[model samples]
Target chain A: MTAEDTAAPARRGRPGYDRQQVLEVAVRLFNEQGYDATSVSDLAGELGVTKSALYHHFDSKSAILEVALDDALSGLESALDDAVRSHSDASAQLRALVRGAVGVLTARQSRVTLLLRVRGNSDVEQSALRRRREFDQRVAAIVRAAQAEGMIRADIDAAVATRLIFGMINSLVEWYRPGGPVDPDELADDVLRATFDGLQA
Target chain B: MTAEDTAAPARRGRPGYDRQQVLEVAVRLFNEQGYDATSVSDLAGELGVTKSALYHHFDSKSAILEVALDDALSGLESALDDAVRSHSDASAQLRALVRGAVGVLTARQSRVTLLLRVRGNSDVEQSALRRRREFDQRVAAIVRAAQAEGMIRADIDAAVATRLIFGMINSLVEWYRPGGPVDPDELADDVLRATFDGLQA
Candidate 1:
C-alpha cells in the first residue's frame, strides 16, 4: 500500500467534497456564527474549496440551509412517525416520542442548533418555520389524544402542554453536547420521567 | 382636561424618547430580525428618530442589547430572590420561580426573545451569557437541595434536571403570544403542574 492508496479513498466522492460533509461543516459554521453572519466565502474557505467548487454542489447558501434544516427535521418527523406506529397507548407513545427526540437531538446536535436558531427571515426559513409549526401541531394532537384517554391531565391545554414538553426536549440543542458527563439515554429517561411522572417525590 | 393636555403627557420624557420605551422597541425589532441583522439605522428609522437622538440614550447598538438583556435578567433574578425569600421549602420555591419566569416571559416576551437569542458576539452579549449561566447554576442548586430533601427524584443529576425544567419554561419565548387563547397566569399554573405533578393521569 502506497501513500496514494492510503489517502485516495478519503476523497473518492466528489473531489475534496462530500455533500453530507459539506452540510455538516455548514451547519457547524452556522451554529457558531449567526447564519446571516456566515457567508458563502466563509463556508468555502472552511471547507478548503474554491467558491466555484462549493457552488457546483449547492446552488446557494439558502439551499445549504434548506438541506441542513431538513436533515434535523427529517429525523424528528421519522421518530414521531415510528412512535405513533409502534405504540397504542397515548402515554407510551408520548414517552417514545420524547425518547426519539432526545436520540435525534443528541446525534444531530449541530444541525438541530441551526434548525432551532432559524428566525424565518427568508423564503427558505419561512418554509422551515411552517414545517416546524406543523410538527408542533401534530405533537399537540398526541397530547390531546392522551388527555382524552385519561392518561394525562386534561386541565392543561393540549397545545400548551405539547410546547412545554417539547420545549424541555428541544432545549437540548442549547446545552447538550454529544460527549458529556450525562449519557443521552439517561437524559431521555429523565425527561420522560419528568414529563409523565412529575418531579415530585 | 383638554385633548392637548392628554397628548402632551404621552411624550413626557426626553422631549421625544423614553429610555425604557426605546429599549422595548429595540428589543421588538431585534426579536423580529436578529440582533446582528438589525442595525442602529434601522432602529432609528423604526423609532422615528434621528441617529443622534437614538444615540443619546444608547451609546451603541451593543449598548441597546445590553440594556435589553439586563431588563429580562433583572426581572428573573428578582423573581428568584422573592421566591427564595418567600418560600421555606425547595419545592414551593421552585414552583414560585417557574411562575415568576412565566410572568416575566409573558409580560416581556419580546425582551426575553432577544435575551434568548444573544450568541455572545460582543462584550455586552458575553456579560449577558455569563449572567444567564449563573442563573442556571443557582437554579440547579435549588434542584439539588430539593432532591436532597427527597421532594424530587434523586436519580437525575441536579444540573441536568434544572436544564430540563427550565428548558420547558424558557421555550415559551418561541411559541407563546401574550393575547392568545391561554392566559399568562393559567399558563404559569399549567407549567407548575407539569413540573411537579407531570402529564400522567
Candidate 2:
C-alpha cells in the first residue's frame, strides 16, 4: 500500500491526528504517566480512538518512544554541531552549546524531559542513553579544551563541569514553562551568566 | 507491643534486617524499579522473606515511602537550617547550604535518589514535593537576601538561581558514587567554585 493509503484510515478516525500529532500526544502521556506505566490502551483512550487506529499511526509503543527520543537527541546533537561549526574558540563554542541546548529544551520540553528520564530499561532506552553519554562526553571535551586554552577554569574536572553545567540546563524541563515569565533568551542568559561570571559579586 | 518486640520478628526473618535495613533496601528497590512499580511482594522477594514478614516492619508500601521521603527531606531541611543558623551572610549561607546538601546527598545517595524521583503520584509523594518546594523557596529567599546585601550577583532571578544551584547539586545523584574518586568535600568545592567564581578564568 502507498503511504497515503496507510494514513487514510487513521486520518478519517481522528480527523487531525496524524503521525506527528500521535507522537506529540504519546509523548505528553508518557511524560505525565511515564512510558512504562502508559500503555497503548491509555493512549488510544486519550486520543479517543481505537487501538487499531493508534496502531495505524505507529507499529508499537516502543516505536513511538524511539521517535520521541530521537526528536530530543537529534535536536541536542544538531545544537552541538551548529555550535561547534559556528564557533572556533572553545569558550564561544561552550556558550553557544549552552544557549542552543536551552533553546532545544524549551522548544521541545516534553521530549527532552522524556529523554532525560530514560533509565536504559529497554533496548531503545539503552541506545538513547548511549547517545546521551556521548553528548556529555563531547561537551566535556569542549570543557577540557577550553580549560587547556586557559579560557575555562582548569581546577574542576572537565567531566564534572560538563555534568554540572548541563545539570542546570536540563533542570529547566522540570520547572520552565514555554510562555512563562522567564523567556527562553532571558533564561539562557541567566544560566550563562551564573555559570560563566560566577554568582558572587 | 514494645518496639523491640515488634522489630524482633523482622530481625529474626533475615538476621540483621532491622527497620533501617529494610528501609534502605526498599529505597534501593524503589530507585531501581520506581516506587509505584515495586509492590509488597517484590519487596518481600528482594528481602528473601514472606510478605507477612515484610509487613512486620512497615504497615504498607506507602508507609515505607513516607519514611524514605522523610529521610531525604529531613536531611535537606536540616542542612538548610544549619546553614542559616551558622552563617550571618547570604553568601556563606548559600555556600554552606550547597556544602551541607552535598554531604547529605552523598551520605544518603539512594534515599536522595528516591526523593528526587518522587512525582507526587501519592499523598506521600505530594507531601515530599511540598517540602521540597518549601526548601527551594527558603533557598531562593536566601538568594534574594544575598543579592540585597550585594554579595551574590543580582542580575539573575533569585528563584532561577536557586533552582540552577540545586539542579547542579541534585544531578550528583545521577552520577556520583559514594567512595568514588570525587570526595564530597572536593565535589562541594567544585560546585562552589564553579557557581561563585564562574567557569571562565
Candidate 3:
C-alpha cells in the first residue's frame, strides 16, 4: 500500500459530505448561534462550500432545519418504541424511557436542544412544535398507562407528571456533557431512581 | 391636591431613566432572541430609544448583561437569604428556596431564561456562571442540612441532588407562560411535592 492508502482510512468521508454531516454542522451552528441568526451563507462558509452547493443539498434554510429536527425526533421515537416494547411493566417501561431519553439527549444533545427551544415564531417552528406536542402526548399516554397500573400516582394529573418528567429529562441538555464525570448510562440510572424514589429519605 | 394628582403615585428618585427598567427590557429582548444574537440596536429598538441614548444607560452590551443579571440575582439572593434564616429544617428550607425560586423565575422570566442559556462565551458570561455556581452551592448546603435532619436521602450526593432539583426548577422558563391556568405558586408547590414524593402511588 502507498502513502495515500495509509492515510485514506483516517480521512474517510472527508470530501463529498453527505446529508447527515451537513445537518450535524447546521445543528451546532443553530444551537451555538440563534437559528434566525445563522444564514445559508454562514452554513456554506462553515462547511467550506459555496452557497450554491448548500442550496443544492437543501432548497432553503428552513428546509435544512425542518429535515434536521424531523430526523432527530424520528430517531428518538424509534428508540422509545424499542424501549417500550422491551419492558412488560409500567415501572420497567418508565425506567427504560428515562434511560433511553438520556441516551438520546446526550448522543444528540444539539438536536434535542434545538427541539426544546422552539419559539413558534415561524411556520417551520410551528410545525416542529406541533410534532413536539404530539411526541409529548405519546409519552403522556404511557405515563397514563402507568398510572392505571397502580405504579404511578393516580392523584396527580398525567399531564403534570409528563411535564415534570420532561423538566428533569429535558434539562440534561444544559448540564450534561459526554466525557464528563458520570457516563450517560450511570446518569440515567440516578435520574430514573430520583424520579421513582423521590428526594425524601 | 387634586383627585387626579392624588390618585396616581409620584415617580421619584432617578429622573432620566430607571436602570432597572432598561435592564428589564434588555432581558426580554435577550430571551426573545438569544444572548449572542441580541445586539445593542435590538435592545434600543425594543426600548424605543436611540442607540446613543441606550449607550448612555449602558457602557457596552456586556455591561447591560452584567448589571441586569446582578440585579435579578440580588433579588433572588434576598429571598433565599430570608428563606434560609426562617426555616427550621433543611427540607423546609429547600421548600422555601424552591418557592422563592418560582417567584424569582416568574417575575423575571426573561432574565432567568437568559441565565439558564449562558454559554460562557465571554468574560461576563463566565463570571455570571461562577456566581450561579456559588448560588447552587448555597442551595446544596441547605440540601445537606436536610440530609443531616434525616428528611432527605443520605445515600445520594448533595451536589447531584442539587443539580437535579435545579434542573427541574429551571426548566419552567423553557415551557412556562404567564396565564391563569396553574399560577406560579401552584407550580412551585407541585414541583416541591414531586421532588420529595415519587410519581408512584
Candidate 4:
C-alpha cells in the first residue's frame, strides 16, 4: 500500500491521527506479513511517523491487536444477532447468518483473517481465541435450535458443524480476490446453498 | 510425539546422530511452535542433545528446513499419483482425490500442516510455494477432465474450483482431531460428498 493509503500524517493539517486509523494500518500489515513477522516499527514507518508516534497512539502491539479484535468481535456479534432475529425459521435464520457473516468477512477481510489465524501465542491472541470460542458457542446454539426444528441433521455435533461452517467461511479470504469472476454475494450464496442443501439433485 | 516415532538416524553405533535425525526433530518442533518461533538451540533442546551435537548433524536451521520440506514434497507427489489412479470415472476420481488427500493429512498431520503454513520468509519457502503451485496445476487438470465429462461446473474457472476443493479438504488438518467426535474416513466421505453434490438437497 502507498503512504497515501496509510493517510498522510498531515493531510490538510488534520489532527494528530485517529486511533482507529492506526489500527487499520496495523491490521493490514499483520495480515500481509502475519502477526509474528510484522513489527511495530514497520507499522509506524507505513503511517509516515516514528516508532514513538505509534507508541503514543497505542501502548503496545498487543494493545492495538486488542482494540482491532474487540471491534471485529462486537461487529460480528451484533450482525449475527440481527440476522438471526430477521427470520423465524431455521432455514431462513441459517441463511441470514451466512450472508451476514459473508458481509463481515468481505468488508473486513484483513481483520477477520487475522482472527481466524490466531495461534494463542500471547495474551492478546488468547483473548481473541476466547471471543472466537464465544462466537462459535452462539452459532452452536442456533444450530441446535435448527436441528430441533429438523432443519439440520440431529446426528451431527453442533460444535463440529459450527467449526466447519466457520472454516469454509474464513477460507474466503485466502481465495476470493476482489475482481474475481464471482462477486462476494454470489460466492456467499454458493457456499450457503452448498452447506444448507445437499447436491443430490 | 514419542522418541520412538522419530525417524532413526543412519549409520548408528555411536549415538545414532546424523543430519536426517536432527531434521526430524527440528521439523516436529517447527510444526509445534511455528517456523518463526523456533530456533536452533530450541531444536537441540527438543532433540535431547547439545547445540554442538545438533550442529554436527546440520549446518544450520535453514538446512534442516530445506531437507524436511523436500521429504514432504516427495510424499505429496506419490499421493497425487495415487489420487489419479484411485478411480476411473469423473465423480469417483474426484472423491478419491479428496479421500486420499485426507489420508495424507491424517497420516502426516504435523509435517503436512507445517508445509501448508509456510510464510515465504526464505528461499526454501519460495521453493515450497513453487512446488505447491505445481500441485495445484495437477488438481486443475483433474477438474478440467471432470468438466469435460459434464460432471463439474463449466462456468467457474477450473483452477478456482480446484482451490476451493482443496480449501475444504485441507481444513481437515486444522480441526480434524482423531478419536474425537468423528472418524477420518467418515469426515473425508462427508467432505467429498459435500464438495461434488451441492449441500442443498
Candidate 5:
C-alpha cells in the first residue's frame, strides 16, 4: 500500500491519527518491546490514545504486524521481480536485486526491522517467514543461474552466497540512518562492489 | 570463561544444574522471550526449579543476563585479541578476525544471538552494548589499517565496510545451526571468500 493509503483520512475512526501513523507507531513499539509483550493497551498508551481509539484504526496487534511484515516482504518481492524483468543476464539481475533490496530497506527501515525480528510466534509471523523463505529461494536461484553462466563465482554454494550477500545488505537495518552521510544509492553501490568484486586491493 | 567454569558444580546450590546449564537456559529464554519480559521465576519454571533454587545460582534475572551477555561478548573480545596477536599484517588480521568471529558465533550461537538482540533496555544491556560498540570500533580500525596498507579495497569507508562484513558474519546467528549442513570452518571460508575475494568466477 502507498503512503497515501495510510495517510488517507480515517473514514470511520478518530480524526487525529491516520492508518499510516498508527502502523508506524505500532511497528516501532513492536520493535522496541517484543511483539508478544506489546499489548493493545501498550500501543494505545504509547500513542496517547484510548484502547478503543487505537482499535478504531486496526482490529488487533496481529493485523498491524501482518501489514508491517507485508510492507517489507512486498518490497523485497517487487525488488526481485524488477531485477528479473529488467536484466537480461543473471549477473545483472543479481546486482539490481541487491540495489532494489537496499532501496526498500532504507525507505522502510522500521517495518523491515520488525520483519526481521519476527520469530514465527504467530500465524502472521509464520506466513511472513514463509514468504521470506520463498524470496530467499528466488535469490538463490538467480545466484545459481549466474554461477552456471560463469558470471558469478561457482565455488560457493548458491544458497550460501545468497545468504551472505543479503546478510550484508540486510545489515543496513542495524546501522544505516536515513538522512545520514551515506545515501541509499551509495550504500547499494558499496554493497555491490564489496560482493561483486573482492575487497583485495 | 571456559565451558568448565560453567559446567562446574554449584557449591551452594542444589544438584543437577550447573552455572553453565543455568546460563544456557537463561540465554535461550532471553533469546526466545525478550530479556526484559523474562523473569527469574520464568527461568526457574523453565528449568523446573524453584525461584529460590534459581536464585541460589543467579541472584537475579539481571545477573543471568550479565553472564549470558558476557559469554557472548567475552568470546568476541577474545576472538579480536587472538586475531590481533596472531597476525602482524592488517589484511591477515582482518581475515583472522572474520574467521575468529565465525568461530565464536558458531561455537556459542545462542549466546551470540542473544547478544545481537540486546537493545540496551537496562543497565546490564547498556553495558553489553558498550562492549559491543568497542568491539565494532576495533574491527573498523583493522579495516582502516588494511585499507591504508593497500591490502583491501579503499573505495568504501572502513567503518561502513566493517559493518557490512560483520553484518554478514553476524547473520550466521539467524540461520547457522550446529551440526547443520554448513560447518563452522566452511562457513568462515565462504564468508572470507565472498568478502575478501569477491564472488566473481
Candidate 6:
C-alpha cells in the first residue's frame, strides 16, 4: 500500500480523513503487521496523521479492531439472512449460504483474515469469537434441517458438517489475494461445486 | 499448563531440560498466547528457569518457531509420502492422505495450529509459508492424478479441489480440542465421509 492511498493529513482538527479511510488503512496494516505489533501511533504514521488525530476517530487500537471485525462478519450475517428468507429447499439454502460466504470473504479479504485468525485474547477479540460461534450455530441449524428433510447426508453430525463446509470456505483467507491468480467469482464457483458435488468422477 | 509442566531449572552446565520438552512448552505458549506476544522471558518464567537456560536449548523465539513449524510439517509430509507409496488407486491414496493428516493433526494439535496460523512476517515465518505451499502443491498433484484416473472430478482445478479438502481437515485446529466434545477417531471418520461423499442427498 502506498502513502497516497490515505489522504494526507491536513491538520489535527481537520475533517478531511474519513473514518472508513482510516479503517481501510488500519485493517491492511493490521493484516500485514500482526495486530500486537501494530500501534495507534503506527496507524497514525501510515495515515499521515498525528496520534491525537487518529484517536479522534478511534479511542484505542482495540476499538478499531472491534469495528474491523464487525465489518468482516456483518456481510456474512446479512448474506445468510438473505439466503434463509429466499430459499425453502434445504440444499439450495445451504449452497446459497456457502456462495454468499465466499463473496463476502473475497470482498473483505483483509478484515476476514483478522477476524478468522483472532485468538480471543481481548474483549474485542472475544466478542468477535462469540459472534463467529453464533454464526456457526445458525449454519449448523440449517444443516440439521437439511439432514432431517433428507436433502443431505444424515450420518455426519450437523455441527461437524457445518464446520467442514465453512472450513473449506474460510481457508480462502489464507490464499485468496484480491487481485491475485484466481478471481473471486471463479473461486466461489469452484468452492460451491466442490462442497455440494463431491470431486468424484 | 502449570509450572510443573516445565522441568525445574538445573545447574547451567547440566542437560536437565530436554529439547523436546522445551519445544512442547514453546508450542503451547505460542498457541495460547499469540506468537508475537510470547517471549523468551515468558518461556523461562513458565519453565521456572533463567532466560539463558531457555536460550541454551533454542537460540531465539524465531528459532523455536522454525523447529515447531518443521515438527508440524514433517509429520504431514511423511504421512503423504507413506500414503502415496502404500496405496495403488487415486481415491484410495487420497483417502489415506486425509485420514493420515487428521491423525497427525490430532496428535500434534498445538504445533499444527502454529503452522497453520503463521502469517509469514519474518524469515522463519516466510520459510514456513513456503513449505506449506509446497505441501499444498504435493496434495494438488495427487488430486490431479486422481482426476486423470477417473477417481475424482476433473471439472474443478486440482489445486482448488485439494485446498477445499485440506481446508476442511485443517479446520480441526480451530475446534478440535484433544479431550473436548469430539473424539479424534470419530472426527477423522466424519471428515473423510464428508469429503469423498458430500452432504447432498
Summarize candidate 6's per-residue lDDT along A1-201 as a digit string, tens digits.
335434454443454677888999999898877787798888988876678878888888999999999988899999899899989977788988998999999998889988987978799999999999999999999999999899888888999889989889998888787788888888888887777767767
Off by over 4 Å in 6: A1-16, B1-17
The weakest ten consecutive residues by lDDT in model 6 chain B span: B1-10
Worst 10 residues of 1 chain A by lDDT: A1-10
Best by DockQ: 5
The true-versus-predicted C-alpha distance at residue A164 of model 3, in Å, is 1.3
lDDT of 1: 0.86
TM-score of chain A in every predicted structure: 0.91, 0.93, 0.86, 0.86, 0.93, 0.90
Q: Highest lDDT among the candidates is held by which one? A: 2
Would you list the clashing residue pairs of candidate 5? Answer: B6-B20
Clashes per candidate, residues 3 or more apart or on different chains: 0, 0, 0, 7, 1, 1
* DockQ of predictions, in order shown: 0.77, 0.78, 0.65, 0.39, 0.80, 0.69
Measured with C-alpha atoms, the lDDT of residue B34 in candidate 6 is 77
Error of 5 at B126 (Å): 1.0
* Between candidates 2 and 5, the DockQ winner: 5
lDDT of 4 by residue, A25-49 (tens): 8998887677786898788877876
Which residue pairs come into collision in candidate 4? A197-B199, A197-B200, A197-B201, A198-B199, A198-B200, A198-B201, A199-B198
**Candidate 5 lDDT, B1-201, residue by residue in tens:** 332336666454544676888898888888887888888878877876678777778778888888888989999999999989999999999999999999999999998998898889889999999999999999999999999999999999999999999999999899998999998999999999999999988
Q: TM-score for every candidate vs. truth?
A: 0.92, 0.94, 0.84, 0.85, 0.94, 0.91
Per residue, candidate 3 scores C-alpha lDDT tens digits across B1-201 of: 122332345243212445666777788888887878889888877767677767766789999888877766776787789898998787988888888987888777778788777888899889988989889899999989899999998767788888888888887777678885758887887787678887767
TM-score of 1: 0.92
lDDT of each: 0.86, 0.90, 0.79, 0.74, 0.89, 0.86
- How accurate locally is residue B20 in candidate 6, as Cα lDDT from 0 to 100? 79
lDDT of 2: 0.90
